[model samples]
Target: MQNVYLAATSATPEVDFRFDSHRMSLKGESYPENAQAFYGPLLDAVGSYLAACRGTTIQIDVQLAYFNSSSTKLLMSLFEQFNQAALAGNHVLVNWFHDEEDDTILEFGEEIAEDYPALELLTQALV
Candidate 1:
């Protein structure tokens, strides 16, 4: 599958998904006017990629400074996809990076960890 790359905008995060390498990352902030429109294609791509893989190690890194409720819902869906991939026997590792002072982001990461036990979630505090 071809890789996916979306440059970061003021209201959206940068999406870099390298299917060949099984690595993906989202950075910056996400509060798009239409969260579904922004995340739908990404979710499709990730689902397709995960569906094609077996016994692969996938690394996903997310470092969003801020996001809105809509973005939060979509982000959880993204993590759910990874969790499913892990349940299918792939080694999925998700690294959630947040500012040291940002309890919200850290808490969100913790929530993901709690919700998705199949995938390994690493909450990293950025200083």
Candidate 2:
């Protein structure tokens, strides 16, 4: 599958889904005017890639400083997809990076990890 990359904007984040390396990263903030419009295709691409992978390991790094409620939902949806892919025999690792001063983001990551027990989730506090 082809890789997907979107530059960060004032109201959006940078997405680098590197299919060749099996590594995906999303950084910066997310507060898009239309969350679905921004994330729909990205999620679809990820789903397609994961569906096609035959026991391939996928790694994801999420370094979001902040995200609106709508974006939070989209993030959860993506995590769920990853969880499903992991359950299907693929190894998925999700590294959630939160600012050291932000407990909310840490808790959010923890919540998603707890919700998707089958998926491997790593929460790291940024320096």
Candidate 3:
């Protein structure tokens, strides 16, 4: 499967995903006009890539300023996919970057960590 890379627009965040080498990242705000439409192919690509891996290491960096509830759900689903991949023995590393002043984002990261103990959840203030 090819890598998935979605560029950020005035209304969407950029997604830099590399599944072959297994280093993925999503950055910026995400409140797309249609959340499902925006995330559909992206999630499909991620799943396809994960299914092709055999003992691969996956790293994800999520840095978001804001996201709507729809996007939030989609992101959580995406993380769950990563969590499942880790459960199958794929080494997964996830670093959630939040601005120092954004307590909400930090807390959200913590909550995600709670849901997926198989993956490494790295929380650090964005510099």
Candidate 1's residue-wise lDDT over 21-106, tens digit each?
99999999999999999999999999999999999999999899999999999999999999998999999998999999999999
lDDT of each: 0.94, 0.93, 0.89
Q: List the residue pairs that clash in candidate 3.
A: none
Instruction: Quote model 2's TM-score.
Output: 0.97
TM-score of each: 0.98, 0.97, 0.95
Q: Which segments of model 1 are wrong by more than 4 Å?
A: none
Which of the predicted structures, 1 or 3, would earn the higher lDDT when compared with the native? 1
Alpha-carbon shift of residue 58 in model 1 (angstroms): 0.4
Count backbone overlaps in model 1.
Answer: 0
Top candidate (TM-score): 1
Compose the digit string of candidate 3's lDDT tens values, residues 57-111: 8889989989888998898889899899999988899999999999999988998
Kindly give the stretch of ten consecutive residues in candidate 3 with the minimal lDDT sum. Answer: 1-10
Candidate 2 overall Cα lDDT vs. reference?
A: 0.93
